[model samples]
Target: MEINPAITFQHDRKVMHAKRPKVLIVGAGLGGLTLGAILQKSDIPYEIFERASQVKPLGSCVALNATVAPLMRQLGIYDEFVAMTKVIPSIQIGNENREVEFAMTAYFEEATERFGAESRVISRPALYDLFLKQVPKERLHMSKKVLTTKQGGNGILIRCSDGTEYEGDILVGADGAHSAIRQNLYAELKSQNKLIPSDDAALPFNTISLVGQTRPLTTEEFPFLKKEECQFVRIVGNDKPFAWSTFTTKQQRICYSVVQFLDEESSKLHDSFRNSEWGPEAAGAMCDEVRHFPVISGGDKITTIGDLIDLTPKEYISKVMLEEKVFQTWYGGRTVLMGDACHKLSPAGGAGAGNALQDAVVLANYINALPLHPVVEEIEAAFEAYKTDRIEWCEKAYATSKMLQSVVDKGIKPMLVRFMMKNMPEFMKRRAAEQMYSSRPQVAFLPLDETPASVKPTHQRSLNLRAPVEEEVEAPAKTI
Candidate 1:
């Protein structure tokens, strides 16, 4: 007779399961959904709350490159994500006259090969739906706005607006820039004189953008849609402080955005975006202003940004203020912030969404390392490590975002930036691309993706972390 190996493995799995902690996530945007998905795979219990009763298509498009593609694969959504996106081979930059200034074709191609993954763009709504599907319907609560949160009963607790309450060992504020949890946490920290001076300041923004995706069109209507490669184009205004971009997608539709770099006086008025609704109505004025902006729709036909605006459903178009800020304080007393809630970034570099997803991954990795009933010190240590591992990357992305923003802005600085980008030395440009593509973090608990790449990825410390397993002590020799 032999002991069963399957039984022994199951016993070990149960031991691992006993160390899992219950997670309470606020917000169901990309970050929150991503964390929930990983926890689902890790067999850790968690719940997600969203203020909206239904998920809305409020954004233009999100580009996923090598940065988070491996994690997407680990989560079992890579193929589906690829199918929904159009690979971006290059980005064509032009001026108000529609004259081509420069193109990043060679750079994009080289980076794609070296990174072992193609950069792909998908409509934001489509992306939201993809990640939302990974989370169980029961675990996601709609229209559940968190009113307040506190630590009690040997754990954390949250009270919803509807008078419902929940308890968990950890609370993750993956909510957007105007996060209620952050507000509450800051208020508490301020009372105790522990809040950082910068963290207490208002969220400053200097650019306002109008983003939308058009209804599907025929090849005859938009010839660019017929092309296998994405027609990615960016245009800088000659006189006005404006820049706009367009991308052809696999859905036979065009995703576009027009940005207005506000002046100092204008920025002061819209400096704090604490209470503002984002939707078509808020974007109506900006739409009218940029209606005449030119776009290359192929076939020598004249197309304006307004034409695409008309093709898009009113509900899908949105006006948003681009805010750039990285809060110094991330976690305090079982409450931690991730994504836009912690590091708000401008969309110029297409890094905001990717960073948010990365935050979810790194954070989930730390949460998975928690013991079944973790003490306060253990929880703080985990949050500190999560922030330590992520802040440097976020700051780098923020700086890159600012640099890209300058290239499209109206000023001598912008002109200089454009010149440098057009004439950047080959080695220098290659080094920059290498730095950008070198960070490809994956889920630590899942099997690693050994698919090789030319550039070595940065080491993720969380991959080396694991919860301590209780050692089996040998029974004392029988005294009887």
Candidate 2:
């Protein structure tokens, strides 16, 4: 498959509207950017509308597993991706005092062996920069906030905050958890009495975190901080659900996140925070909240959360609540949703980004499978297939994320399970990895037999975008 880095097109409204289907994607996060990359590769025309003027991810770091590697390689940016990230081969779990409670070094190797790519950690901004590099400037309209989407005659119409309306054969919501597109899509469906059971409420979140990248901590200051593939995991206690993760990125810098679960109080503080300005005072308060939390390095070297916070430039850190929500109504008509719009996830399992990219892969495959100048029926069927392929996993992903969060939080039984995971047999650990990654979604366009020769089995499926015309996949009816 040929991956085109960018495709520039002059705006010819008549030709585009009369010919092939055009996709209008909301939100330029990972999912939207990934979809744009796929469509560009397929020579499909599309536009990405982002709320932000520039595509800089809010979080400090993003974890990429083997599951999405093939697609990355297919994009022909694997080398760049590799250069921008570091393999996180070791995950050392510890207490507030930094005393080692349990460690898992073998799982990373096993995952690489079983899944065909090494798990990596990268600066979130760098990741977005890579995607932005591939996407043509003409195709991405920054600061164009999408307000609503409605079904047009045979396509979909989108209204933006800037008093603009755009039309496309299909509209996709990659607009994060609190998606305006998702809300409008569901509202349209509800008006027709066709809305399915959806997870509308924000995930019952009690966790608030501040994550940022800072100047690298030297090996002399923190021994394992510079070690290859080292990922430090710190859990304060079960009494209060709090955890800290510190790891290295590409540049001479480290990224850290401190999360505190507000289970004791009403989510009011969190809910109230949504509208408040996240200015200096708020960031400072969040930093002060966990400044004294101990983060252990090893035998003797120890530091508090404040130490790293003090080193980090004030602008790098982001404070936000971790949410986990899964919606049942993924699609109706030509409007469909992907990524955080449909399924939100906790940061525990590091599954959100991977899952969103997977959504791009699967959804692209289905859309690419369409015949040239497809009718409304074909577009609708593609949307149906995409939803059917993803809804179950969407729900399961939310459950799985919380399940891992429990282990990280270590309430009671989770502590024992965490212990077992720490010293588990190599064979058993690999088995767990095998099970965990067994059903990862694959792009329909990628060949089962990879191009650049994979050393390990890619254990992922490919969608046959170009199928026999005689055989047609029945468009699934909308589900409850």
lDDT string, candidate 2, 65-153, tens digits: 77678788878888899888888776777775557776677647746556777788888888888888788889999989887676743
Top-TM-score candidate index = 1
Residue-pair clashes per prediction, in order, are 0, 2
Query: Model 1, range 1-480, lDDT digits (tens) per residue?
Result: 221212211133333435566899999999999999998987678999998898878888988788998899898899999899988887788877777788865447665568878889998989999999999899999999999887743677788999999888789999899999999999989998999999998888889899999999888777788788788889999888899999988888799999988888877766553368678878887899999999977657788999999999999899898889988999997889999999999999889999999998889889888765676677889999999999999999999999988878888988898888888888887788878777788888898877777888889899876755655655779986
Please, what is the TM-score per model?
Answer: 0.93, 0.86
What TM-score does candidate 2 reach? 0.86
How many steric clashes does model 2 contain?
A: 2
Tally clashing residue pairs in candidate 1: 0
TM-score, structure 1 vs. true: 0.93
Candidate 1 regions exceeding 4 Å error are: 1-19, 268-274, 470-479
